[model samples]
Target: MLRTLFSLVISAAVLAGAYVYTFGVPGSVAAYFGPQQAADSSAGAAPSGRGGGGQFGGRGGGRSTTVVLSPIEIQPYQDVLRAIGTATALRSTNVMAEVSGEVTAVNLEANQMVAAGDILIELEARNEALNLEIAEAELAYARETVARYEQLQTNGNSTVTGVALSEARLALSLAEAKAGLARVSLDNRTIRAPIAGRLGLSSMDVGDSLANGSLIVTIDNAEALIVEFELPERAIGILQPQQVVRAMTPTFVGRVFEGRVTSFDSRVDPVTRSVTVRARIENPDGLLWSGMTFSVELSQASAPLAMVASTAITWSQSGASIWIDNDGAALAVPVTILYRQDESVWLEVDLPEGTLVVTEGAQKLRDGAPITSADAPRGRNSAGDAAAPNARRDTAPRAGAPT
Candidate 1:
């Protein structure tokens, strides 16, 4: 019987330890549960508040949540389309040799400005000149022989057949002489610039024997530069010739080049679903070069729209929306986004002008939940920046305050 009594005491000690661990000491447990039961009884007996719900009780009698608000306004908006393009010379060509010969003289230097038909290279032509002279002498002898034969036939000293034969020989010699002249002309062998522009590096040097059709140099007309870019097929109807465009390149930072739309492709690319567009920019100082990439911006002015801070917009399963203050209660209003800039977004919504929209602390709000603006004095919210106090209203219920 004594051993059984000792076992009962040990069991009682184990139960006391578990109770202390789970609920703290008995006095501490009473301290924790005492206030909570009294607070619940008080909140149930109180009248409904604007916040509409208690922190842990049924709807109503809760403290208002604080949020930052911004007033809705109308602002001028412009739609802009951005794209990348390549800059090219208005006119460019690869100058080539028309005839083959040894380069006896190089008349042009690299990066030289030249006019059309300016001689660039000359080839040797002494042998061609000699052949031309010999052909001319033979033609002269034939002409004299034909004249003599005609005169003899008139004086009855030569037969008609003899005069005819002499005439035929003269014709044959004339043909040979004309052929020699053409050969001599080809041997003149001078390569001239086809168009006026700046020249690139010469491909052949003095004494270099070049074949026909070989590259001589490249020339580009830089009076005007062309930028070619692609635009979506949907933009075909909106684009027009002579529309203003702005372009920028990495090579020329902080400088924008203005241009006008010059032309567009007639057919849209099936693979990309885009159309090629060309714009012309004047380059009088030759600052822009061919094959450089440029960032292009095209803008179109439009009517004013409602504008708000981009941070005010929030997305959910329903769609994009923003929280607005209605009689000191949080109300979510859906909006359709129209355009967006760096700091602001233009939207299409039916909200009245001067409506206060929440820009911060929106996550703690529910429909019809009481709210206090961070701009308010007694309800200051640390999560949001303070704004004009006149913009905030004190319409929500507060803790430990009259109804």
Candidate 2:
């Protein structure tokens, strides 16, 4: 019986804790439906308000409407940060064999840098040399036959059929000679770099027997590097090209590799809902390599704009809004948000001069409430140092005071 009672008590305690987390605490109240402040304003010493539903409009001499002005500054509407990227080699190729034979020469080694057309292999060519010499002799004989055919035809001393036969024999000899030359050329089996790049570990040893198209080594163009990374699909439309980005590898911690966005995938993957982006960067000093893993951070802010507002001053509902002193009442001033950063919303609105926006008593009052600024807190309610144009609104007492 005691165990059962203890279990009940523990369960009740847990339920109470969850209630506090979901609803509100008894003394200190908070709600997510509203309450925002401009981030750019200097830190406010105190900003406290009650938690409740609906637009709060206060009607009392307890608080007076004051035109609190947010200090003007530029803030960027960032594209919710993106994946990191790094500089990498742009082009890389694996050297392969076109012919086969015993290795007679090895011009490059593992880790050696090579240029285009640089020979890196050789196959023994004793048979090929003999074939080339035979081709030259055949070519000479073919030329002599052609000359004789022409001479006979000019002298009109040979039948037309005889001259034609000689011509056919010459053609055959020429064709044979060309075939021989091709065979000889293929015998050398020299492999050269197709591009200027760094050579990587070769699977070939000095005596490695390679067939045609067999990979000899890998070459990577290190003059420039490109990296690809994935980001959330929602981030695709807002991302901009040439945005500065940085990356780092575990092996090279604390030293960032700089890069920029070169392109982004046109569409998001259906299964993953992520977009892939490519970045190109200079890989000077041959530091970046292919297939190396890296962590990257891509900046999403398009550009800083003048007249951005502190995000905290804005409240959210089905859309977003702000508060201001309207006529004799605390007005729920709806605003268009340029961006939302943490607790602040970078926003913009067109308003006449001397418009008083409520930075305090927002949760306790509504749009038509008669407000008394006497109990309003000192300083701007954005948890900032935004000074109101009127001294009365700026110096009002804080929240939790007698109305």
Candidate 3:
């Protein structure tokens, strides 16, 4: 009986092997060949195969889970504004020759600092002095002739015409003397500085002849430096005279100079829509020179805020922006900034209380780009946010909490 049972068992095993070989895989031919089938099997299993499939996939030990992805949830982030600014001297001037003369000597050298009324250059005046002496002699002779004519008239010995002629002669001599005096002054050809400033390189040398109104050399008031910049006409609302400003300059690296808005242009630039603005900075050491180029940054009005975003997202032209996730999609939104702190920006775009914004990858998406929810940051937008749809907006992640 035992022998018979063994033989029967061996026959059954051989039959089963032959059946498997002929059919390849019994009820799992599709499972071996199809990826969907493999994934379905994994999804159906619990995270660690501990239990049956659940609504949420478990962690480490839990089996795989099936998730239906929707759209990415991004948090709002601060925006940093950037601009390029130019620099200028606090005081500047285009000095010109005040009198006509040949440049005899240049007292102040180019690029040297000088005081007010400092003798800058001189001209030859020997001829003028001689002419003044001759005028003095002529004037004395005229007065003596007038006295002699008066004596003759009083005695009734001189004719009326004779007396008149004598008077005319005296007047003519007096006028000649006055002309000589003026000519004498024309030779006082020492050029004096009009204002205290740094002298620029002179275009004239010792022998260079200069006419009145000729350009002598430029002088700039480097006692302090002034910077002029252009602002948008729209800024008419916020700027005030003497408003303080701070900037970084090439000459003063990492150092901030205190400045004030001194003035602004009356009209706006039609093309650039910018109006001129002037800021003056103190320079007692005379370190800041004229014609120096510097970069600057300014704000019309500023304050403190909770968050900010990219200006590019603002979309319309200026102001703030928001990414409205309407109908489970990402959309850009614009807002006005409340204030700017440090390099980060701040805005208040009255959102509907609790709504997620698409802060990053703004260029990658349109108004309604599909997003997925995986693990996202709270209160900040960035790439690689959650994409698979799982949580509801009403139950969105809180600030400083993991998404």
Candidate 4:
């Protein structure tokens, strides 16, 4: 019986040692064993930082979690908006003949630049020209007759009576009216440019018969180009005249055209919930042609938001969250992701700028858990004293202060 009891006691001792080594000793047991552990962790054993004053303060014998802390920065976010647009010339028109006649001359070639009122096509006006000549001859004869009669009247000659001179004056006025009409008819046979622009190809030749108002050629003032595109109605607040815009086309590889917003449609389309926008770009080189498909882009600026490193974010069953160093305790703050760039994430959290957030070693932290910043200067504890070996000292300036 004595031997059996001794054996059982030895077995119990071995089990206890194994339990302590594997999972650590309980606080009550550690206190019973010695005072060294209790004294070393006394400072971190205070009330939980999260609960303001609670029993659950720290973890692992009141040891602080070592982590990397980064300051939250206020950064402006920009959303890129893209859409397809059709390009058109700043001014365009179709030149046409005003009168029916055979084409006597073609003054413009394909892609020929012409000035306003420059003659582009001339029709066969032989009959109209003959009529103008006859009218002029009659007008000259009437003027001579009227002069002779007026001279006789001034000389007080009864041979030219007042009624005869009145008849002659009426004939002279009729002759002048006919002459003006003939000149107008002759001018109608010529086609002129309505605007200064480059002309398109014309099918008319010297002998081709053209009807009145027939299309002669197309003219485009391509000194500048206009791009028409649509954007979601949600951008209405930010869409304004003179806003900068950029456009690219597949035809012009690797080239971008810069322009400014000119106008927006008065109302949004009910079906698409989009608003039409027009932008103008200078085309001095004439490289961009009308009726081209362009990829339009606009940088939509957003309000400033708090930004932090992407690795700082942690996820839970509840939602996305991040660990913030509240004083010396880890606090999990819920954040809504607004935007994500390469290594940074913009958050829609209520935390003030310059708040320290844990970028690494956050996975091992719990709310109210004591935390020590790896970035903090050496030889300081969570209490800002020279005790804990893994403590950190912050040297960064306060937020909103001049650098």
Q: What ordering of candidates by lDDT runs from best to worst?
A: 4, 1, 2, 3
* Candidate 2: residue 199 lDDT (0-100): 85
Residue-wise C-alpha lDDT for candidate 2, range 1-403, written one tens digit per residue: 9999999999999987665443233222323221221111112212213221222222331223333333335556665564654445799887778887778778767778888999888887787777777777777777777777777778886565675866767686776768677665864466778898888887565776778777788888877778888888777666788877777777777988877778988888999889988877677787777777778776566565433335326455646666655444555666676766665555566664435555544555555544434434654332233332212222344356676
Q: State the lDDT of candidate 1 residue by residue for 1-403, as single tens digits.
A: 9999999999999987654433223333335654444343333332223333323233223446667889999877876778899988999999877778888989778878899999989898777677777777776777776777777778887466765866767686786767678575765587788898889887678999989888889999888999999988777767889999999999989999999999999999999999999999999988888889999988877667888999899999999999998766678999999888898999999886788998987766678666777677753322233321222334555566798
- What digit string (tens of lDDT, one per residue) describes model 3 on residues 1-403? 9999999999999886554333222224434644444343343322221111121222211121111222222234422222345555555667677678777888768788888888888887776667777777677777766776767778886464575856768686776768676674854577778888888887677987889898887778776777877666656776679877776678768887777778888888889988778778887887776667656566543333335344224454564466555544445676765555454455565554435554543444444444322233432112343422211122444457786
Question: In model 4, how large is the Cα lDDT of residue 235?
Answer: 74
User: Which of 2 and 3 is ahead in TM-score?
Assistant: 2
Better model by lDDT: candidate 2 vs candidate 3:
2
Tell me how many residue pairs clash in candidate 2.
35
Best candidate according to lDDT? 4
Worst 10 residues of 1 by lDDT: 382-391
Q: List the residue pairs that clash in candidate 1.
A: 52-60, 53-60
Q: Rate the local accuracy (lDDT) of all candidates.
A: 0.76, 0.61, 0.57, 0.81
Better of 3 and 4 by TM-score: 4
Global Cα lDDT for candidate 2: 0.61
lDDT of 4: 0.81
Every model's TM-score? 0.64, 0.64, 0.52, 0.74
- Residue range 261-334, candidate 4, lDDT tens digits: 99999999999999999999999988888889999998877799999999999999999999987767778999
Pull out the clashing pairs in model 4: 376-393, 377-393
Runs in model 3 deviating more than 4 A are 1-91, 98-101, 140-184, 207-213, 300-403
Candidate 3: worst 10 consecutive residues by lDDT? 59-68
